[model samples]
Target: MTEANGTTELPKTCKAGVVVNEGPDFTVAVEDVPVPTPGPNDLLIKLNATGICYSDIHYMLNDLPMGSMSSYGVRSPGHEGAGVVVALGSNVTTWKVGDRAGIKPVYDCCFACELCWSGRESYCDAAPQIGLNFPGSYQQYVLSPARYTQRIPDGVDDFVAGPIMCSGSTIYCSLKEAGLRAGSWAVFPGAGGGVGHMGVQIAKAMGMRVVGIDGGEEKRELCMKLGCEAFVDFTKVEDVAAEVVRICDGKGAHGVFVTASSAPAYASAPGMLRISGKIMCIGIPPIGTAFAGADPLLLIGKNLTFSGTKVGSLLDTARALEFAARGQLKPIYEVFPVAKLPEAVAKLRSGKVAGRLVVDFNA
Candidate 1:
């Protein structure tokens, strides 16, 4: 019950997020919209903070699959969010007013699907993605299925917890896919960005040595500070693969998480893995893009495996938040007011952001 600017009104007809039309020219802008109501088994949340994810940019750029907007009648594009539940429907008993909740990537899934039944709901063929398919958390208030939302513990702040809903969980799930045990070496290509930074900490927490590869001296320093054993400035390194091998004692990393969607990262991965090393792809490459420079023969020769992971399931997201509450995971973020989202998105597009950019709705 933190007061917003010391006000109690809570602004019923408050400002909300809207993406005006879709396509390559889609634009996200704020508009005065009605506050939502909770439906059966749903909860209405007053968002305190939400992170600007790469997929938000990708969706805005027409680089991902956005569900039919004609059915929903609005363009609300956000998922990585942390807020307080304000209202709940009749069937929702596990949560109540003022409970902390996270609206993540996997908004809902058909429980009848085989993948959902097996606890791998993240891969459910009929999964519904918030921001892509349904209304999401960029607005002042959002309605989320109570069962799909993860609880945020008391001590974790909303601004820091928001990004975990998507970027943090995605990287955590990708690292899980790598199947590296303690003492293994894991490389993160975009080690200073939102997901990559989280990957660095998650790997380190699991007792793995991490080599962070990214651009700029500051990013290198940042990665090293975030528990990466070594930092390579890919922008300055002449041979990225050679540097990775050099850092791994002339063999190669045991696992590499490609958190950067750039072509070169994927192109250099096969050469950066040790024999039988796994490569986990977490980035959303541009639409219609393929894994460049990766050959089937090379995979067969080295006994290498490649896996692409999306964001995690509701259960996985809950585990991720629990890890954060226990101090095993953290998200580096730059907070801004909701009015400044366009500027934040602009900085994100220009690669000026040092970490995850979060919007503070209460600011």
Candidate 2:
């Protein structure tokens, strides 16, 4: 179904991993869904791969205080997507058919907002999230605004580019905002997970020494291979913070990036930092389940600061992709076919995935 204009004919319906039940006991089942038409300013994307993130689990479980996906009638939950533009909206002149594009967490934001103008568009309250409010990447064919869609560079593959859309870019922005100088010790609390592993590589690529904290031998090996100077297994250690402090020249880490959503990880973060060191919060625990803070006396005594960041802006995502293109940031991931998407989601929910898990839509 090829046309003279090089546009491939789109199918009337396509496969999708729809959420069976929108609750804590939910399951994702593959189903046939109708392909949506692009708006005047949108591009119809045919996704090739999408990465499974823990945030997807949170959306399905409906644990976060944020509204549930079902409220907005969004059944599929995913954000990291890489694909080709199969059809272009009549008003879209910047992109053409067959161009490579990527979809991130923030689907669209109000360009008139102050946050959007200040390079923090991800925080714009008026913006709609991909998996939360809109149909997400789990669907085979998705519509993306031509202005916000990311252009995939020549050297980076779709598999690596997929996770970079969210996990990689998010951590890169966190490390950048921490403002730690090169050679400074940067510690990642969940160094073996999808976001933590990317932080390790990005931190190393920026010339910072990375010390990873996680459990199990598989994660240790993975972290070490990905450029972690030291891997601390929390399961075997009596005091995880003490080990991190001891590794950083007996002082403490310059910056501690909390990537694990567990409450204990946030509780022990301050104990792993030196005087004037900072804690950059990236993982979001369920509301009222955990809090990250230190005593006012300890904060004043040590001159410590705490900060947090969400997904990166368009500029940050571009810089992260540049790092990948230059062979600096390499994403460690396992690929699964579309039929095994449910299994992949279950594995991610269990918290045993050493690296990212990607689902290939065309496989």
Candidate 3:
């Protein structure tokens, strides 16, 4: 059992990636910082790894329409993290030392809201995101709320669990919202990307036939290895949507899960869905950019539904973790040590990475 601030024999400082510019030209600097103490409802976690989400890139660039990370008083930017509990706060009991755990995009949500009560806490209007509001998992240690923290299961490795906390879980919720059954054709616009790759695996595990659309041969190979039934190389295909429609038996896919930020992905999504099909969105396009094809006439004519999810509820994370454990949602990430986080960030920003990039803090 841990006692208040002295919870465990912990070091005063730990290595972390600090955002220097805090804006579009931001860069990360590896520095030593004081380890944060857990509050009454929090747990101090010693993170082993964190996933480099595209959202992290957005936070560092201040690209979101919302206020800057500086406005939120956050410097380090990250969300998907997996580690073990090191200490517990005065009121924390749901977790203990050595218990594997993970953090998600949402650090904490107003649990009293109707959304939270209905198990949709990820959409809480006042929720403070991990990398934005609180110090993110880019550090060696982070504070996680007892209620918001995820319990990483024994079978799921930390490397896989990290991304599962955010990207994996986000797509998992999208799959659920899609309500796709076995043998249904599901189209993933960016099937080789982080969220899309996980979505491919999850959709497959759910028995859905997947048609993955992306650019380049590398992405196509990754999608196929991850169990996508059909891989569509958008860069080579004359008409990606038309090809997807053909792959789905001439009408359209049962659903189109858009996990790519490209405007064309959203614009062409409506054409890839079957009658009564839904578009489950998890990607964030550039600020001020709207889904151009959201014409009510088209939606009404096709009986298509448009719904989206941000991160995901804790339950959603749990389900995704299970999928990873079952070898259904395997990660296709390039692992980098914490010291190389800046390089990982740069590579992701440059669009050179075919899948997710994970940072290992212990290194």
Best by TM-score: 2
Q: Can you write out model 3's per-residue Cα lDDT over 1-363, one digit (the tens) per residue?
A: 383355347889998887898776888888999999888888989999999899988888888876777887778889998998888888877776788989899988898999999889988897888888889988888999898889998889999999999999899888988788899999999898999999999998999999999999899899998898999898888888899999899999998999999888888999888899988888887786757357788889989888877777989899999988887888889999888888888889887778799998877
The alpha-carbon deviation from the true structure for residue 109 of candidate 1, after best TM-score superposition, in angstroms, is 1.5
On TM-score, who's better, 2 or 3?
Answer: 2
In model 1, state the lDDT of residue 99: 88
Q: List candidate 3 stretches off by more than 4 Å.
A: 1-8, 290-292
Whole-model lDDT values for every prediction:
0.82, 0.92, 0.87
Between candidates 1 and 3, the TM-score winner: 3
Best-to-worst ranking by lDDT: 2, 3, 1
Clash number for every model? 0, 0, 0
Which regions of candidate 2 are displaced past 4 Å? Answer: 1-7
- TM per prediction: 0.93, 0.98, 0.96
Q: What would the TM-score be for candidate 2 when compared with the true structure?
A: 0.98
Ten-residue stretch with the least lDDT total in model 2? 1-10
lDDT per residue (tens digit) for residues 1-363 in model 2? 121156546689998999988887899999899998998899989999999899999899999888999999999989999999888887888998889999999999889989999999999988789988989999989989998999999999899999999999999999989999999999999999999999999999999999999999999999999999999999999999999999999999999999999999999999999999999999978778878999999899999999999999998998989999999888889998998899999999899899899999989
